[model samples]
Target: MAMKSSPVVLKTWYVSIACIMLLSALLLFPVRISLASPAVLVVDDDGFASPTDCDGSDPAYSSIQAAIAAAFPGDEIVVCPGVYSEQVTIGRDGLRVRSFDGSAVDGTPDTVIQPGELTPAAVLITANGVVFQGFYIKDATTGTGHAHVHRGVFVQGDNNVILNNKVEGRGTCRFADVGILVRGGGVGNGVAENNLIENNEVTNTCNGIATVSIATNNAAAYTTIKGNTVKNNLGIGIAADRTPSALVGFNEVTENEIGLKYNSDSEKGLPATGTKFRCNDVYGNEIYDAQNIATDNSIMDAEFNWWGSNTGPDPSKISGSVDYVPWLTAPKEEGCPQKGRMTGGGVLRGEVLFINKTKVSATVNFGFEVHCNNEKEPNNLQINWRVGGQTFIFHLTAMNYAACFETAADQGMPPAPFDTHVGSGEGRLKIGPSPWTPATIQWMFVDDGEPGVGKDIFHAVIIADSTSYVISGKISGGNMQAHPDDP
Candidate 1:
């Protein structure tokens, strides 16, 4: 009976013993992560360490330029595959070297680094939020006037983000070397965007992915080139010159004789007018082979892009001048191009020939000279005319494989054995009658011939070049005599 102490029940047992000692110090503490805020430094040419202590073992800072010189602004330097050999740079605050496992970089087929063994450009990144990804850089050797300025990823700095890396050997680059050489004052003003630089492949190198502009496009703006496939590169697969205002899309610039090259060294320095090149499939790229063509000036897609050029259309003409059309369901072994691809001589009706260079008078104005390489689809086209022996019963509502009907008919006339039996596919062409013009003519069913033996037998003229004519002789009845003055 001596207990009388009640200071409000000892202030509720001292606040329930300080809430159970703050839940047992939040279940035993030790989760404090913030290496001075946003850190991840890790290097390895064998367990490296520069200013050491980003933790993970430290072998005296293995080397990503000595852990990026002791990292700072949003630090993150993984780097571990090996063979760094070194040319290092990446200055100006902002780091991200990556590759602890995300995989991608080949720099030149798995890291080689020998531009005279080092001092070239193993990987000089100059920062501004730097982000280099994957890895693979090669021999790089240069000297013929900075020998293309060696690059495996030589970005100058400014919002940099060189992703998916795999730069090739520069093959003795003369002076504009590139694997990924983004330039322009203060590192092209940043914003290299999403960055996949995909599949990562490059060769010979003069430009695999270049974006120069030391002083244009008002100091270079938005850069976003997508997908990136660029093969064979001697001059371009993805190039944006001194006028740099890049935004090229999808990216699959094939065979590379020059798939996407836009320049402006001194055309008064233009470019920056919206700049957007879409979809991208860009074919074998010979750009129309005039010895690797130079000034045709379509300057990469003014829109969309397909220009592989197989052409057709314009059947008997009426309007259709080509803007792009050749996908014909795509798959006749995949070379399947056909919406239009026409060229020379065409007149598929009971084709049989004779046009008065004195070759026996069947010249009632039967013309054929097609050369329409499809400016478009010229109304899809169709030219049927089966007359007598029906040429395998004629049935070609026009699918246009460049419309063929050859047997050579204009002066020097002779070529109409049913246009060589339907152009070797052994079909079509066999019309009959009309020696003195009663208007039923078209022939070719010869075999001891004359006056209805097998029936159809005029089979007009439809020749295709390389001159060497002969179809079993005799088609010269002295101008079909009914008296061209008693020939």
Candidate 2:
């Protein structure tokens, strides 16, 4: 979205394989996901395309809706790579519908859900405590229904999670409303409270993300919209009001009409009386970065944010009573980030390796860091690997992995990016995701050879967690440089 920030860090902390200390933090901030389900329902587009295209004899479900219909309350559904042409709904509590091999990285998305026919939305949630992740949801502009009902991803349930997905072009056809909406007061739906909408990209809609209530006050309360990029929408990037005490934090809001807004429903007469916006990157809006048309003219807490200017937000860019003091001089950098990725502690650059002459495997082009090394630090590691047709992309924050480098004066090595380095550390080993699925893995690497001349090494072992691999490998192919830290 043309962000001016060079480094993006959002303070992510859901990692660590070295320390038994992470076990305590896991308990303190436990995601409501219980892997103790009866069975995992697998959905793939290999033999199915539509909701009814399931190959019953093949055992795998054909459509997302079919899996939901047959799933139990706590069951987890894993969907493979495909562009699904149907709308989805969930009525079962605690059911997780996730795309198989996708993270927050747009290069490799979870699954694609572009509804063929026009409906109210691409996905609808009336269930509580459901986890919807890893999908690229868009082209859902299919209805003339109410603003609340017409969205890319709409939620009327409580404690639900919307993570690591990209939602764009949502209300283009009819109600230009919201890309993702979390509202309360649905007749049969549960109260939309304490819902976490994190690590998602919302753009090209009327509004990016919103938490609201039409039934009564506090119906859609305490929504946490964090670690997301909200930009290029027609109206508000993030709208939190009508419902009370909603938090909009650690997000990048740019290139929109309004970066952040208070709920302005003249019909309901809700003036966004109580909302808190903090620690966000807000700028590049065509109109205003933050527009608070609160009828009450009450003071809103809009502090700790990066408002495109080190001095502070421009007076004309923000409206109403907003307290925007003590702002960040630069973009926020933590575990997870608002813009440019906060990569690993060291720099990892490499070339490709073709094993069988035809198969393109072992191609590494990424920067990784170990923020999971300490208990209090964020788990932010970014690694990209390709074996055959499969690529594993995950990232952690602040302190997970650790490594050291040998410079020219220190052991006669090359400078920074071209230095000889070796190190090993433990971490949860995920790229871009929630803490729900953590894999305990330890890894080691050596970049001791010349860049482009070959001889870089990489290896990993699944010492703990799920039953996966007792792995090892040898490599000597590179012109790439590896550093223990930035040059």
Candidate 3:
């Protein structure tokens, strides 16, 4: 005899069993434990761990990739000073990778990262809010089989920062190599905005510090390159491709095929609208200092920059649609060598005899050298300009020493202080750093092929507070080599 159970009792028993099974599954649940705070991972290629916040594990990571593999978001990795031979990629966001030793003795990091043979890049960032700092990333690998594009540092993520790093190619023979490249492909843009490339030295590559737009993305629109040293690249220094709102300022762009370049060459046909370059020392390029071609008939705003000149940027050194008015009279940042654009210094020796307005005979002789060193001292002058038995004293400073070497053909130049290379100016005289009297100094130097007793020549008109003396003479001896290319 079998007892027939009701549907309600049977359903209650099944529900109880199901509840028990659910409880068992919950007990065996697995979870990924997250660190309470950002952890510091120490990486030393030689496995020596000492200089770090975290105790260098008995055996730290021997390579940078190993440390990154074990890193989580918001973690920091400190690398010891050494040469690392491998390609590195950052996939974790909010992570910072830096050198453990911050003793930047040479303005470059001792922690060097060189791309391995046939690697694509020295370091690549594919995550947002990451920072790569204080590493000398150089292209040292060489091979025949290579990728179409190679770079020292490549950033494809947004809000990433790269500061105080030296990315050099050492004249890499790679088919195409860039020192520091920021780009946005179809999968890369949108979030690929507001990335900063600052205080970096990028040199000796095809291009230095570039923001490129490609594949339905305009990463260049939100790029910023500031306080960077971009120089000696094979191609362009600070190239912006189809950048619409990019800002480039306080950068040194020099000694390349082209200095600062912006153009409208993108798949989206975006013009360089609202792009501006300010406070940059742009000069010494082989071809063009700045080249802009706005396809949309918009003016490329490239004003307020020091283009190696005080009068203006060289017209022939620039081409295309660029607005270069209102340029900086001197280098925006100090310590840059803007030697030729305004004034020049030389070691001069001359003697002249003239008759004063009182019909008195006066003899003047001077033998001195002027050097403008913007490092320790801004300028240096130690000269005795003799007028008869007294020395001609000017109540001014070494900065007022505006001398230039030009040809006899004034070359359609402006007059007085306006003629930079012609070297003529007037200033008040100072007695030992104190304003004493006013004076006007007008002088000229002409290089007659070489320096000799009667070859190169000079002339001067000295107007003192009470007396005026006019003198002319030829270089008796010494050197009058005027460098329009040094500080």
Candidate number achieving the greatest lDDT relative to the actual structure: 3
Could you give me the TM-score of model 3 versus the true structure? 0.59
Ranking by TM-score: 3, 2, 1
lDDT of 1 by residue, 369-410 (tens): 221121223212112333233321121222211211212221
Candidate 3: which stretches are off by over 4 Å? 1-34, 51-57, 102-105, 117-119, 170-174, 186-191, 265-269, 334-487
lDDT of 3 at 484: 39
Pairs with steric clashes in candidate 3: 394-429, 395-429, 395-430, 396-430
Q: Which consecutive 10 residues in model 2 have the weakest lDDT in total?
A: 335-344
Model 1, position 208: C-alpha lDDT score:
79
lDDT of 2 by residue, 265-285 (tens): 445655453356766889889
User: What lDDT score goes with residue 250 in model 1?
Assistant: 50
Residue 126 of candidate 2: its Cα lDDT? Answer: 81
Task: State how far residue 25 of model 3 sits from its true place (Å).
Answer: 32
Each model's total of backbone clashes: 43, 38, 4
Please tell me which model should have the higher TM-score, number 2 or number 3: 3
lDDT of each: 0.43, 0.62, 0.65
Stretches off by above 4 angstroms in model 1 are 1-71, 77-92, 101-131, 135-199, 202-208, 212-217, 220-229, 232-236, 243-257, 260-262, 267-487
Scored against the true structure, residue 318 in model 1 reaches a CA lDDT of: 11
